[model samples]
Target: MKDFKVGHEIGKGKYGRVHLATNKSSGYIVALKILLKQELKHDKLLRQLEREVEIQGNLNHPNILKLYGYFQDEKRVVMILEWASLGTLYAQLKRQMRFVEKQASRYIAQIAKSLKYVHERHIVHRDLKPENLLIDKQGVLKLADFGWATYVQDFTKQVKLNISLKTNGYNTHNTHYSHFKYSSSLKTICGTLDYLAPEMVKRQSYNEKVDVWALGIICYELLVGVPPFESIGFPLTIQRIVLDEVMIPDYVSKEARDIIIMLLQKDPINRPSMEQVLNHPWIRMYNKSSPQNSTQTKLTKTIITNINYNNC
Candidate 1:
């Protein structure tokens, strides 16, 4: 941390600020996340930071940002991560009203693959949105921000380690499965309002299917230029999510509509698994060389042209 020279502030969050930093040791540029120790002492936020670092460290994929290292001093905790030069997917999408089907598919496919990997390991990324998806200089989409994630087994394991005391002031066998059950249920409500699953809005029991619902929202937004359930305000949006209200604009393609329908199912049990999603017709169309290459060429030109015009 001492060797690194912190540059301009890139982003800010409630808990901390992210700075573009140069690692003097390796001469590598990285996004350094610095959080104050007083902020972490809150217990809830500290646990979140630990979970994010732990999960991100374990995950290694081309579509996931790499974590370099972390150091903590008396005042702050610093985490170094791969610097994505091109900014966020949200910014890129905002610049271009909506992405063509081929362009959206490539990015969604990469995210689905990453989610599939994380889900298989029993990790549920409670937060997945365009803002959390970063674009590298090479135009690859990477899944970032694991601060809201949790391990399914870790909760159970922690419960087992703590025993309940008897009423007679003696140690007794813990019958606290109900406690863990409630705790697990609460975590589902920890996701963002715009991208939260139906079950998450209802504060009911859910699992990895929640991520699929968010991905579905991301896909819909990609196709139609706005989230299907989003309204003019946060309250209205929350109401729609809780009430299972969604609107699909006529401009959205049938292929995209079908995929969205399957993913946005009210019942988490009925939603398509990540693997099934990967092989879905809409996704399969993106894998073909002809369509993929053609779309990439068109998008690359469009992006370059827009950048040049803006520079002028």
Candidate 2:
């Protein structure tokens, strides 16, 4: 704490609050996320916290929020993070109601590229939504909050090795086994209820494809203002996700609709990979380099100017 000067609260979360701070030496500004030790222990989230640090610490991608470092005192754990000057995508979405096709496509493409990077590393981001996406001053979208993310190994390769072990008559009990170190699909039912994929709704094991499913939902929400499966309550929403088909409005271009349909497939096997999502026609069309930055910066500044800075 001595290395910096903390300012007024900038954001709040379940764990604690985020404050705008500055490095005393370099004068670098950062967002300081302070998680309460007592609250973390009471919620039995110590292991989750450790995993969050481990997973997010190693991640390096332009579209992903940077976790500079972390320090702890007796009662608080403070994480130094990249400052997102434009606030969250959720707030912008709330104010604008919905985004145009071009804007939505550009944002989606960035998300796909970032997710592709993380998937290549065998990590899955269980929770993905506008609330967890931050926008920087330059209008760059960043993925944040890796508390529910975890590493997953290829099931086929591990299964083949396990079969070899059995054939050699080596007692499996003699070998050390840990799901955290090695796993095929993850079965834990975590993440927001609204964005739950079909397999997740059914309480079945799911892979990184779950993030692709969420990408579809986010795309839909970005263009339509609300999630496709949103219903009166949790049960109805679960039913919609499991049994109902997505109905993209006719106003949405065919290419945009096609990408959304491809992503929201009920079966995980049917959904496109993150690479495919990035290469989708709709994404590739508006994802052009030159126009994206200038347009995004203008739109972001316009929207941000309307937001009440005091609350943020």
Candidate 3:
């Protein structure tokens, strides 16, 4: 950790502060997220933190944040990461209130592509929201914060998959679902209330479809200028999400609106997969905005060449 000289705090997270730092040898700037080991141990979150570091380190995609590497001392867990100069998606949305159809779709499409990549590896990001998304200097969106993620392969299907999302949006509790059978896993009511699918609300066995619901909410917020379930309190908001009625503002393009509607479907199985989302008509609109796909992958990979990982 001494190799990187930490600087003034640039941001704060739930359990830590992010500093603008630089590597002494390479002179490369990075975002350093410092978490107190004591707090994590007290909260019984060491496993979650370890899991996050493990997951982020293994993932590599143009639309996913780069984890350069990490090491922990007795008191603190420090992560050196690629700095997202443009800040978080939440900040950008707050500044402009919303994005035009084309701009919004471009971000969504990129995220969808990344999610597809992860899902193919049996990982589920239980928490997905504007604040968890960051924008780079190139305006490319990348996902961050994997504390709520879980690898489905590690869990057993022999037990019923009735996972109940707890209040924090990070933990889940076990409950029974009488109507369901078979297995794929990822249940227990995870994710934010605004983004929870109806099946999750009912505490039924769920899968990656919950992420699609969250992505749809993001798409709606980008175009409609506000979260569909914003305002009111948590209780009322939860009820509205369960009802599954989201009004796509008239200004949203019909194709864009249709995708949002489909993504927000009350039935999880009915929602489009991330692969389907990438191919959606709304996403196709962004294809011409960027250059050929061949160069895109190579350029993005080159940008994070300093990052080293064991699993990926």
Candidate 4:
């Protein structure tokens, strides 16, 4: 492990850098995410790192990143994960301009299935966007980066608080007021602004539904080559999300628009659940018409080429 060859710096984030490394013993290529120990000293960041490992470890789906193992020295924490040779979905989309409806549907369905598993396990992946999704050489999508995810049980409890005070000269007696208690609201705004749900924009209490909203945005982007609510800046973007300002491009198929609208509903309660999304008419039709043979052939060739290249 100490003498492992680091080929290239594949990615970097707030926590640390990710490198393509080859394990000498097993002769396997792995994506190594290195986090700075100093940064992890902060309670909040440490919790996020721990949660990422926990959530990723629990997810066994093909659409989610596979966590192999982790190690820590005095300076850094190194996490070994599945290597997706093709790189991020964002780069792929950028290269292709946009994806066909059938392709988009297949990828989105896989992502929905991943989210369904996460939600069922009482974990919310607060940040899910193209940048966080990786495509392997096989063209399979793997959801990555769980820095903003949190356990549902840890966030579902309501807290009660009462305040008593005497205000001004007019108030001679103690006045007590009780704040209405709801589920523990996530306070940190840790996602890309463009994909945030309406409830998230308002800083309201949210759950797994937020991930649905993000998927909708991803769908829209895959169809229109950009997000549905693409604004000039953060303030304008937040304003648009808060105002429910969204439009389905004319080029987008009617079925795709319908799915997007359902997922991007202003009310989180009204948004389609992951199961409903999977069963949606648009998804069903797309799945039926998917070019399985073509996709499979391309994927096989790509994976074989990458593996052979690595061997060389």
Candidate 5:
């Protein structure tokens, strides 16, 4: 604690706040997530707090927020984290409204890679939203917030691929990283309802694909400046998620629209995994902007001024 000096508060939440902190000896900057132990104790969230700290501490990926280290004083727990110099994706979205499809494609593909890494390790990031995604100085996307995350072992016992669709297109389950789910038909609803999958809202057994469902919503929102199931009230939003079709705008490219449908499937079992999502055509668009293929480039003759003719 003595080695790090806290700066301005960067964010505040229900139980804690994020701050800019600098390491005194190395002069490295980091975001410190500080939680008052007393507050957690009073709320009886001690176990969840420990789990969050532990989860963040164990993750290691370039596109995942790095939890450098952590320690606890008598009063609080301090977490050292990667400082996203460009702030959050939510702030960026607010200013820009919606990103051009190309930019959004690049960003989401990076997130997919991060998801692939974590899912491979059986960690389910139950809470994934724009506010939890941070961008670094180089415009790289990183996933943050592990408060709602749980290991597949904690909830799932075995892989289940059976899912049934409604006569009018509704309830079902499919496999996307369906290798595991919470044991004993996992129970518990968490995270914001806006991005929650239908199965989650229906309180059915779910797995990592719920994260993919949220990814689909985020992809749509990134293109349209709003969520697919926009509503004026909470119940309305929940109703939409459970009953409404995922409608993509006409302006969206066909490739991007298809990926959204694949992701936001009514059945959790039908959604694509992060690995499959990244391989989809929409994500492939990220590599289409070649400098040689752009209007910005023009072929021109080059003359060498500094070269000696004798050397040639």
Candidate 6:
């Protein structure tokens, strides 16, 4: 603990708060996530915390937040994390309402790249939302919060793909309509309410495709200012997610709308992989200005280069 000096509190979470800190010798700025060990133990989340550290520590990517290291004492667990000066994407959304198609596409592309890297390693980031996304000083997006993440040793060894829309009810024991063998699939119902995939809502075993489903919801939220399936109540929200068709505004570009539709397919099998999402036409042309905005290129560049990281 003597190796770093802690400063002002920057954020808070379910079990802890994060503070700005600096390494004593290196003078490197970092975020100190201080978790109360007693609270973690009381909630029986010790293993979950360890898993988060293990999973995030091993991941290396420009678009993924870095977990530098951690230490613990009798009362607290302190994690050293890279400092994202610009705060969370959620905060940005609250301020800007919604992002332009070009900006949203670029952000989505960065997330897709990061997810592809994680998925390729057989890991599933079960919880992905704007709140879990941070922006660095360079205006780059970084995926954070891996507490619900898990590593699957054999994601490809799943034995079945039979999913029936007419199933009497959602039953993992019903092999006649099971999408994947329960033994080889993840069955834990997790993730944010609005971002839950259809399979997750059905209590069916799922895989990394759940993350892909979340990507679609996030993309829609970025462009439309709210989740596609969001409703007034919990039950209604779940129903909407399972049965409602997403309605993109006519103002959204065709390419952006097409990607969102492809990503939000009711069937997980029909949803494109992270790699496919990254390679989609919208992502490929994220830097191109829309026909309606002749000055968008300059405006975008200015927004990127002149970000007031400290204020954000």
Q: Per-residue CA lDDT of candidate 6, range 55-150, in tens? A: 787887778887766765445677778778899999999999999988899889889988999989888899999999998877878899998998
Tell me each candidate's TM-score: 0.81, 0.84, 0.83, 0.82, 0.82, 0.82
lDDT of 3 by residue, 106-220 (tens): 9898879878988898877878899889887777788888878766655432222222323344434344432212247656666678777778777887777778888998999
Predicted structure with the largest TM-score when compared to the true one:
2
Give the alpha-carbon lDDT of every model.
0.74, 0.79, 0.74, 0.75, 0.74, 0.78
How far does residue 189 in candidate 4 sit from its true spot (Å)?
A: 1.8
Point out the higher-scoring one by lDDT: 2 or 4. Answer: 2
**Best candidate according to lDDT:** 2
Model 2 clashing residue pairs (backbone) = none
Cα lDDT of candidate 5 equals 0.74
lDDT of 1 by residue, 54-114 (tens): 6786776667776655665446677777778888899999999999998998888988988
Candidate 1 vs candidate 5, TM-score winner? 5
Candidate 5 local Cα displacement, residue 244, angstroms = 0.5
Off by over 4 Å in 2: 42-44, 154-179, 290-312
Tens-digit lDDT track of model 4 for 1-312: 373577789999987999998765456677889887667655566556665765675566667777765655546667777788889989989999999998899989888878988889877788899999998777778889887887655533222211112223232223232222223365556699998888877877777788989999998899889987888988888888878547877887889889988888888889988999999987898776432234433433343334322232
Clashing pairs in 6: none
